[model samples]
Target: MIKENVNYKTLDLHQRDEWLHFVMKCETYDVFYLPQYVQMYEERGEGKAQLFVYERRAEEFVIYPFLKREIRGAAEGEVYYDITTSYGYGGPLYSLSRLKNDDDFVREFRAEFERYCKAEGIVSEFIRFHPYLETEAGLASYVNVTSVGELIYNDVTKTEEEIWSEVAPSKKRRIKKSKRNQVEVIFIDGKDIGPKEILIFYDIYTETMDKKQASSFYYFSLDFFQAYFTALKEYITLAFAMHEGRVISANLLLKSEGAVTIHLSASFKAYLHLCPNCNLRYECILWAKRNGYHIVDHGGGKEKDDSLYKYKQQFSNTQTNFHIGKKIHNQSIYNKLAKQKSKLVQGEQADFFPEYRQVLVTPRILSNK
Candidate 1:
């Protein structure tokens, strides 16, 4: 039930051209916002990807891409759903070509979004906002926002000397040691990625994950990589560090209009002493700089100040806050689902948004006296 004077449009995965047009019109957008990228997630059975567009006029609008997931057993005979960003940073991107007031536009967008959610049986929504864009702050009025952690990035626009100076002295020593060891870094465009490279990367990445005891979510299938390369060849780059004729480390770089994201990286455990990872990052920074990218984003760790986060901070001190947003449109349905979840799980779940989706805790049985 769209309100009067609220000009808007909704596009699904089938409408690729129209969807891409809107995304390209935005002044700033990342690979995560692309229809092809979201389609991959949809094909993986994550959800049905949909782009919601609210047009203020011909050239000004707000476009939000999200995955609509069905809530199983939420109600009898009636269907309900929840929306979430697809496994990465994303939120509403606005066209500021003719915008007068940022706050005014956001407030109006929020009201209309809420209405759409209600009409479509959307109970709640979860958003992982982009750190660079900082879109969450403006929605603080309507959405619940929280700072998750901080991410490190290098402003590639700076001169090469300035960029090098920002690297921690200790890391600089390691990078030099890596170069002295004859460790060479090479870049392969996604189009050039072959089965052999995919197998090598998969082996290294899975081994690293095993040593770290990473969550199952980090263990991606080989087919996923194949699909990724096929769908996003132009925007993907594989950087491999070779030592004495063997690939020792690899990093998957995702490129956008103005930024390059170090999406995933791994190295052989035995080669840690060579500091191949350090050299790879430095080379990647230089590559991004030469390619006209403004920033090289080294995403945050699982938690603040963790070993992973500390490693990224070695390259640059510049940091940005990562935030997440939560919104509940159908309070009654949300409460019902949460209550049902509470009966099944053993612990308090007040802290988890959309509590019904929290991991179930096994219940303990009490001995009868």
Candidate 2:
């Protein structure tokens, strides 16, 4: 049964502490649901963020953080609005204990939210669901939900020997060879990290993204990382691979509630042959295992069977599906803007939501690092 007098509220990114306080009340949640994580993109000028809160009673609330953008350059001054989840896992973080039936509540909440979007003339929405968290199944019926791919997970509950035994033979060889090559892994607390160390990580990360011809969205400013480290110091763990006193590779891990997510990683191009990245993962997994983390999530690759996925598979045998959800309101207007966008861009418009923004997706020939 649905509760009566359900109220809706919208809060901008500035009201972060209030929003996060609400998140902590939820029966289940993940670190990505934290406001600080979403603020990272907003602070970098990614888009205008609007945090939507749905309350059935004073005790129960669900929060969805959306980034809104105007579809520009379509016809003579015509514009359409589209929103998406910020980089990383995000969908809906709701109070499970507050609802009699989680699925029913989600459907009802989404219904009200759709009405709001339609009234505002917002065309569409996209979401990246949290892999480790539990979400209602019926959400797919309301939105275009599909398995993008699988994110790899390493079970930290196993003994160190058991964890090492599961590694792919090739990767095991690489790890041993990396040992012979003298790559050392070091963990730096975010609180202790300074501009010197920050620059080292930034240089390698940006250079790797540049080499892959990554999109502009991946080009985060140094200040963006600075704020992130400063804001989430307690949860962040930085791992660095050094060779002859030179930082050759680095990875960022976010720990919360007994799980560690392999947030980001990069390695020097010249050091790829030395297997610095392999060593980095090896060390991180060991650290997670010994530190009482229940799992280490190695996010998926560009594609299911891509070289990147193959490389991650060597570290863990457990796999979890990654899903992306999309929904469109105001279908008539959506069609109009999509048609205009198809004509504006070269070749056929990508099957992306709000086809007008198809230009955002660029061709990339991913190579192994």
Candidate 3:
């Protein structure tokens, strides 16, 4: 149990320095937890980004960053909000190495967090837990945790040969075929990315999106991509697959402390047979290894073992479960909101949590990372 002396702190966007400093102190954290990353979403009117820190002792704490969005039409003249993690994976990042095993500390953190939420009019929270970090397990005892899917990642800490040896035979053939077809892969530092490169990526990415008939949420504006390249330049890489000197595919790699995530990727449909993406994936693993990154996260698909997930599995046999945490702080208010939503919409998806937000036109939050 936590003592009365223990305290918590909330940092807003204005406190970038303090927010980053706290995140840096964590034993492990993803780029999703960074202030600059969250600020992009905030600029897009996603919500007001806030960082919550619970301190057990000096250099021992749990830091959770989320966007607090106002719940519209939940009540009359009563403003209620719900918190959600950004598009990518994130949750409470613990500083103490042994914190995961300490049940009492997690329970206390939950109790305190619930109190804070109620006091702040935060009716609920939704967390997309980190797959590699496994941060969800720590809160499973206190929160509702559900295994959403499995993600594939390469253990780049291993030697290049070892990593290659683990690649699925069919994937190896496709990568080899790509090489034979002269599918050249190149890496561009995000700092070096400019208007021309952005346009090339935008054209190719949007083409793929259109082909897939992806939702509006997947179609990020060119300005958004520009801002992304600028804000996260130091930790970003643009990898492109070229055939006959034409850009055939492109991927955005996000580098964290020790892992590199394949953030967004797309390929020209005409070059699909050339297997440009396969070559791109293999080359990315090599690039990450050469650059000292320890892992390559090829995030999961919309559903478990879906086509996209199967495609990523070819790169690495290693897999990790992606879990999400859901919590409701104010049951009465939550029920009221759900009831209101039910009246507003004909059929609300029973599975969509915070049930109030299930309007017909509201885009379902799809996992992009």
Among residues 3 or more apart in sequence or in different chains, the pairs in candidate 2 whose N, CA or C atoms overlap within 3 Å are none
Error of 3 at 211 (Å): 1.1
Per-residue lDDT of 1-369 in model 2, one digit per residue for the tens? 123543576677678777888788887767777778777777777677777788777677678887877766533655667788888888777776446247778777787788668655577787888877734255766877778789999998999998999899988888888889999999998788877888887899998897889887677788887788888887788999989999999999998888898889998899888888888998999998888899999988977879889889989889999988877776666666777766542212234665766665674666576
Question: Which tens-of-lDDT digit does each residue in 1-369 have in candidate 1?
Answer: 235766566799789899999999887788998999988888888899999988777677888999999999889999999999988789888776334247787777787888788778998898999888766757888888888789999999999999999999999999999999999999999889888998899999988887777766677788887788789998999999999999999999999888999999999999999999999999999999998999999999988899999989989979999988888888778888888767543222246777888775433333345
- What does each candidate score in C-alpha RMSD? 5.3, 4.1, 4.4
In order, the Cα lDDT scores of the candidates are: 0.86, 0.79, 0.85
* Model 2: lowest-lDDT 10 consecutive positions: 343-352
Residue 188 of model 3 has an lDDT of 97
The C-alpha TM-scores of every prediction are: 0.91, 0.89, 0.91
- Which regions of candidate 2 are displaced past 4 Å? 1-6, 73-80, 97-101, 343-350, 360-369
lDDT tens per residue, model 3, 185-262: 999998899989999999999888877777676888888888888888988999999999999999999998899999
**Clashing residue pairs, candidate 3?**
none
What TM-score does candidate 1 get on C-alpha atoms?
0.91
Model 3 score (lDDT): 0.85
